[model samples]
Target: MDFLRWTLIFLVLALVSAALGFGGFAADFAYIGKILFFIFLVLFIVGLIFGRGRGRTL
Candidate 1:
């Protein structure tokens, strides 16, 4: 849920930046968006790993 919210916010920001013709700002926002995307991916993978591990009774 949090990831979805952040992703939406990032997309909005990217769109706004692009519309404003701020290439540097747009690039920065894009970089942030990429980072956030990776973070979300990592969180999802960790959750999956832990969830599966939980069922295995470590």
Candidate 2:
């Protein structure tokens, strides 16, 4: 969740920086956002895979 939040923050920053014509800062923010997004994806997938059937009534 935090990763996702930071990803969104960086992405928004990248958009804002680009709009303000700060090309270098925008690129760096975009890169960080991309990395955080991927990490969030991997973590989400791992959680889905390992978090099966915890409260089954068997």
> Could you list the CA RMSD of all candidates, in the order they appear?
3.7, 2.2
Best by lDDT: 2
RMSD of 1: 3.7
lDDT, candidate 2, 1-58, per-residue tens: 9999999999999999999999999999999999999999999999988888466677
lDDT of 2 at 15: 100
Pairs that clash in candidate 1: none
Write model 1 residue lDDT over 1-58, tens digit each, in one string. 5875787688788889999898888887778877888888899999888888565455
lDDT of 1: 0.81
lDDT of 1 at 29: 76
